[model samples]
Target: MTELSNIPHALKGLNSVVVHPDFKFPDADVVLSVTGRCLYEKQLLVDTDIRSNHSESGGASTSDDDEDFHSQTSRDRRKEREEKNNPEKPSQATLFKVHKSVLRRASEFFADMFSIPQPSNQDTIDGLPIIYMHDDPIDIHNFINHIYNSDVLHYLPLRQSTFNMMSSIIRLSRKYLLLRLAPAAMFRIRSDWPTTLEEWDKNDLQVVAITRWNAQVRDGSQDGGSRLGPEDLLVEPCRVIRFARQENILEILPAAFYHLSRLSSLNDPHRPRSCIEGRKRAHGYWMGGGRYATRSVLTPADWDTLMIGKAEIRAWFVNFRQYGWQSIHATNCGADDPSSCVLSSQGGWKNYWDEVIGVQTRKILAQDGLDVMEVLQVLRHVVLYDENLCSGCRVQAGKIVGCARTEFWDCLPDFFRLKRPNPWGGIWMEGEPVDCFEQSI
Candidate 1:
């Protein structure tokens, strides 16, 4: 619902994370990848040299290069280059020294593996067991990173690469059934692709997502959008759809569809990434890398909702002029309410066409995309801040806007031609359906 509340004592929160309370996950036992040379092996020899001289004074347990999560981030490429140039760097693979006890607490998968009846026959580098994985080495590394930095609110950096990392963590967390991890992973997911109106109010997350999105799509941005694909945040509603479906996160679909409709403005599937090069770069981006490609991620029913929902929202804006909403007006203007009684002089009855509420409403509708909640914000701000309206009438105006918002929400399913996820009495209908995709994953 909000950013995490943990503050570090170091830079404390920047590029760093707090350890779990039981943070005794010492020595990485999981050997993610074996290298040609012992990266750690070289560092140990240097540390030994430093410590022997100090032994004559007072010996100390010094910090090692391979300490805590082994910043293996970019070192793999560097390690490869070094091995190629100097073929005599002691041919050994990289090793991770991790704690089996900590892995057991975080992952039931590991717990089951450890519980299997066998001689503790696994290989080890430094007394710690080496567990090899068939998963992408990058993903495995990112998952282990979270285990080390699982501090609340201390999230990974908000870069495009981070989004890739997030995708990995979500899948891994769900697969491993990491009970302690679901909340943090899901919170990040919710911030980017919220399903509920309340979650959509997180402006900070929106700003970051949109900024990153704009950089990647129509024409690439100065943003590192090159690394981000259409399936990435710049334009991937399918990503959210698959993730929510996989995780049984049913609530994310509706709001995600809302964002998708707006996103469709930039993403014309027939358009190529080549069109937006150079000068066309600053222009709006279409996140749908391939229209058919993105649509394939959703079930037919979900696809119908998105298509109908988008058209219906645009239709709602057009029909506002002809909708005959006269019955919804309230005229019980309090005796002291000058604004209400005086509007008769300007016009017989107030409407969006009236000079008072004119143009702005149309301006919002005319904007490239229609985000219903955003429209409501514009409407509310106009009504609440109008100096022409009196206190009592302002209160009444707010009531009217509230009523209209409720009405809009209520009719959403009907507008979208959807029977499920309806706002029944302003609440989502329970057990609508999330099994649309019965994937083995």
Candidate 2:
């Protein structure tokens, strides 16, 4: 257990027993002394160029230069001065007075910890046993808040802050063996990042709608300029990918990678989208509209996986264009000559690719389309609705497209070189170990 004196080191002269405002249980029997750095301060390599040794607990240790350290020290001193003047600020909290029963009920770690006989010389604060932890104070607060109020797990409205909170809960829950909370958190994450083709379509449609809306507003075609921007509406994929990799959340990796791959590879031509765009700036990429830019924090290995997976998706589309439709056998044609209809269907497919598909692909993605889901939807819609195409060819096209979509989704894990865990796409059942990510990642 960390001494109470050590609390001042992190809190900067703040009282050792500064209780969390929301977690100040009246009948509390334990004090959780959260002594970890703020979550954002624990950077996992801000720049891809700066390499550092990673700790076993998945934290990277960067060797900050003298100037960086000096700047950090100056900021710390400024914060300390501010806190000294306003000591009751919520950010000054480093202690949580929580119930042991709640902890034991929610976490196996706490249950085991309490089950053990306490030392005769155990330290106590306010006549309660003190349990020191090296987890972020905000994470501890979020974890306990979730325990007290289950509503913290609701990941609706998909904001970066929501994701960050959920991530903190997931990380701490997994650390302390909160079996139910951990899996539930994972479920929320998977829900946001589509794992199935149908879900992907829904997400893509939302993005498409937002992109069009933003475009219209920008061009003075739409009236609602006060509406939320794309950045406010959409969650960035690269950040999700980073958290997933850090926590070994393998199931969400395929969808995350796929989404990231869809963004334009070129850098933002306009001014920096964010303040974090200078010395330690992240790489920038954008989707179609250009109203919002995503700062990507991908490592070399992640980039390699993304590039390789994207290439595989593009190759699948190219191969499907040439050979996939050829195998479609048109049956029960309403045409006078069924053979002629089949021949015309093949010609229609060629013309569709040449005129519609190829042009759209180039215009949107600036290359051959890497988004298989989008292309598949377009192809199916044209085949089904075209007045000229026979019903027989339409049905065959639907089946072929459906099968191709499924095939592509199935290949996502392999395409990204990710090991898919059993019982993916939902909350894990009781006693089903949730640490199913491949050990080697």
Candidate 3:
């Protein structure tokens, strides 16, 4: 057992716990410790049907008696094998002891497996039948962890390992056909993505996860500034978008593309969309190894779609600037006078607006692939709550931006070039998981 103090140091998760990657038993990195018991461990690796390691209950008998007993046992075993329709049980079988009732209740696969009439050679330990699994042991451990602890989702802290763990849970849940467990896994995965501007603002962990998924970010690298660069943005969101597309989960794409475009510089044609533009700022490694490298995971079609969406969003900005509403007299409207507020209502507001508000908003909203939360911050900071600007002009500007929002929301699907519009026809909201079994997990 890991000592309580050592757990903080030993809070290990997969560096890249991918979809059942090449694995072996007794690996130091992959382990599960819970409820004072550990599964899928070296000590627990046992061949249930074999008793080579077992000790006799009593002293050894005479050679003649032992020979007679062994011959009789062999004859009984042969008879048992010949009598049943079940395939010959393995002379040696790996064991995982779990509650039969839990398996029966949680999965139809288990229900069916256990439904088979017991073989005479079936093995047991600690009052539980030995249920052998052919899956990667790590996957089995993760899935069983969820079954044992329904509140396990809440226990997951915000960290780089979080997504990888959840991915493992989801894969196993789907494979075993754990219908109830599957949605919960999907829900947590879906929740990692922020749907609204508010959710985006509050979630730094998601950003860290997005950043860490592709490139490893070290501790203390997160400085509260414009430290996030395009290199940080490209790999993770694109992979996620690809995942969503494969899974037929359209809801996750709009925000994903929006973030991707901002990061990829798709909105700004002047800025080159170069992959790995500079010598890597943060030392990191590629998770996808060998024939499929992480850099090439984003398919060509995905690249084209993201670029198109970026161009489309930038085009909207161009249209808005050209025809939506431009202030004619770029000056202050003293109570009664009329003045347009494109940059700002007052002359001073123009300088701050150009340098601070508009520029950052453009980068955050159009160029730098990120969420709108930062842009909203600029808006809140720029919009005057006092008697600095005309009430009528404020209303007009508000109405313009409001209308722009509606237009933007309506066209997000077209922005991302998705084949079919999301069912909500807008940003995905966190709620009941999509009910279609085909697309559920």
Which candidate achieves the best lDDT against the true structure? Answer: 2
Residue-wise C-alpha lDDT for candidate 2, range 1-441, written one tens digit per residue: 223343334355533334443354556788888754422222211111112222233332332321232244326646656666775664533677788998998899999999999997676666777787877776776677667766535634455445655787788876799887888777777777766777767766766776666445545634422233323445667878888989887778888888777666453434444455521121222224432325458888988998888876676666666555354442334667865664355565566445644654555444532567777777768767756657766776666666666667756766666666663433444344432122101
Q: What is candidate 3's lDDT per residue for 149-196, written digit by digit as tens?
A: 565567664332344445556666666778777787677666666455
lDDT per residue, candidate 1, 24-84, as tens digits? 2333344343333333221221111323343344532323332432454347557667768
lDDT of each: 0.50, 0.59, 0.45
Worst 10 residues of 1 by lDDT: 40-49
Please tell me which predicted candidate would have the highest TM-score against the true structure: 2
Q: What TM-score, to 2 decimals, does candidate 1 have?
A: 0.60
Q: After superposition, how far is residue 331 of candidate 3 from its true place, in Å?
A: 15
Question: Against the true structure, candidate 2 has what lDDT?
Answer: 0.59
Question: Which stretch of 10 consecutive residues in model 2 shows the poorest summed lDDT?
Answer: 44-53
Model 3 quality (TM-score): 0.53
Runs of candidate 2 exceeding 4 Å displacement: 1-19, 25-29, 38-93, 114-129, 151-162, 190-195, 202-235, 265-296, 322-325, 330-334, 337-349, 359-362, 365-369, 419-441
